[model samples]
Target chain A: MIEQDWIWGLVGGLMIGSAAALYLLVNGRIMGASGIIGGLVDRSGWEGGTERAAFLAGLVLVPMLVVPLYETVETHITSNLAVVIVAGLLVGVGTRLANGCTSGHGVCGISRLSLRGIVATVFYLLGGALVMALARHVLGVI
Target chain B: MLRLLSALVAGGLFGAGLLVSGMVDTTKVQGWLDVFGDWNPTLAFVLGGAIVPMAIAWRVAERRKVAVLGGPLPLMTEGEARPGRNLIIGSTVFGAGWALAGLCPGPALASLTFGGTGGIVFVVAMAAGMLAAPPIRARLDRMQPA
Candidate 1:
């Protein structure tokens, strides 16, 4: 069995793209999760703090309302606290350093055909694959 | 007010997409990353699906000077869009972390409402990491040749 819902994935992706489009066309901003949050923390992009906060609030709150209507959301996060913390820190720092993430780079960046976005996406995906292979196959750590 | 509302709407939809597309599911994400194992291609679909509308949107943006809400659009200048070492290195590190946890910022936050103590811990630590990034980024910028 495939055990994956490709159709829902497509539908949801369309929604994601639409959200990005709306964000770009209406608010004139890139819908990047890390960029939005990072700006708030570093205080560099404070001019749009309210808008960022609103978007974040929506990201945090809307799931609460909608997730309950369907099957429970599940995660395969490791049980190791150290691993979780380290991973979180890495992601936070990494996205900031890169200036984008899957949303910005993977979705918006690629769609716009920006070389930077494409390159970043390729690197990240390759990195993820390498780590996944090593961790799962070689070290068996994660 | 309208700007805030638009942001909220965009965010809500984005979160919904993550949830509906199963991007919030760490196992699925990890599965996709597991090329040598039983790799799942759901993520590819999600990416493909998201790109269609966004590609159209960018085309729409190309014609407009300002956003509907009267804000300046994020249209890039010629040289400003170039990829650099930071993007490569940072994305590499991020991918490693993502492979480890199968969680990214968006899903991490969206999962917060139900991700329990573990989720809280991750978000807090991630926030700290984000706060730590500015100094690190500044240092990297300093190291670059003028």
Candidate 2:
């Protein structure tokens, strides 16, 4: 896709990993994006609300500041209105039900070799691949 | 103070990484998932690279009870670490959504500053889902008892 995408991907990956490491080592918390946000949504995270709020503020704010620096950032996300809504709903429910998302399970969970994390990662990847094949190749909806 | 600061810094760095790694690009994410079609292997590098430092951090964390800033580490007990039905079902469902939109929670939030109306819609829906999950989960647990 983009030129040298792999290089940028690698560099970005290191930054993410370093962030996770810093969160773990310094804060003593798993840097799971879903858990942080979901906790607030369900009101289960009220006890530690300030920290979660602060984290989310940065999560949202940093991109605002940094994205302007780039010439362009193309997401290529689906434009179909219904698809967007449905996908969003599913992502929310699935991640909450599973008790983690890509960050919590994929990066943080798997890093610690937790069975729950590993299993979730495998299943999600499988689910994603199956849906991709069906929707893109067969149905041609998204 | 330290806790909040660390979270802020960590969150900032994580957001930047998502942007830099091109994880915010739905096409790149979709291309990686499109294994049978024209495959893009860039995401693999992102995953592999992220795992390296995190794996090391886990090891380093294992030897310590408290974090460097004096907080309780996320110590997973045997029960907490085990996989269950919800984990399987939820992950699969999440995957379907990810495939549909080519964005996950991290990328969804990271892209919000520049993601336009679609990003806003997705985040809102995702938040709704999160709000509804507890009751649904409670019912499911009642029915399944597991």
Candidate 3:
């Protein structure tokens, strides 16, 4: 049985909020993680230098900051690097193909009540659930 | 300055929510899916907890006639149903992949805050997907009507 910690939820919310703030404050972009991470690959899309670097850096560095505070953090991921690399690549391609990443369509777009965003998000959730089922249950890949 | 501050507020709140919900962990997600094995209910609680904020936010935003995030407030637009054949096929493909990855963009970033090799890989691949999609879209768009 998996345990749910309310603290983690709160932390997640703040990170998402701070990231969103940083993105908009300096770059005028939404903190849609997909877009930010995606921008790393397509840097030309972003105009500002200090802001983009800082924003992207925050994504990478903020977690490192947590290490000192939390000391050691552990996670459950059984997939090898090769699997992750391929998955990440597929998601990058998917976001561009679908016209928005999960954060853009799922968080901001759906929150905005955009029809396109809603449709995209529904598909995303369903996709996520299906993926989990297939990987863990069907394939027995931990 | 005000715009930036407000943006910060919104994002901070969003990050906090991810932590509180335990969504930062794919194991939690996998637990939810492996109902026969572990039968995790945290996902249900998250779905439930989300309702509270959603209601409050909806009501407040409706009353204010403004989005707390600032910008032109968005209203729902119900367009004439034009569900294309491609939409169905595309959704099928997307759902399949998401089920496999468990690390969608939002959590992947938050997971990065925790700093792990898998999380890093999850994010890197997600970025690649985002980059490759556009050209594919352009190609398809060229074949279809605007």
Please provide, for model 1 over B107-132, each residue's C-alpha lDDT reduced to its tens digit, 9 standing for 90 to 100: 88888897777788888888898998
State in Å the error of residue B143, model 1.
4.5
lDDT of 3 by residue, A1-142 (tens): 2333544544454444444433433334545655555665677456543443454454444444554565334446545777677666666666655656555655555444556666876776666666666677778765
- Worst 10-residue lDDT window for candidate 2 chain A reads A70-79
- Report model 3's interface C-alpha RMSD after superposition on the true interface residues: 4.8
Docking class of 2: high
True contacts kept of each: 0.85, 0.85, 0.37
**Best of the candidates, lDDT:** 2
- Candidate 2, residue A106: lDDT: 88
Residue B144 lDDT, candidate 1, scale 0-100: 92
Better model by TM-score, 1 or 3?
Answer: 1
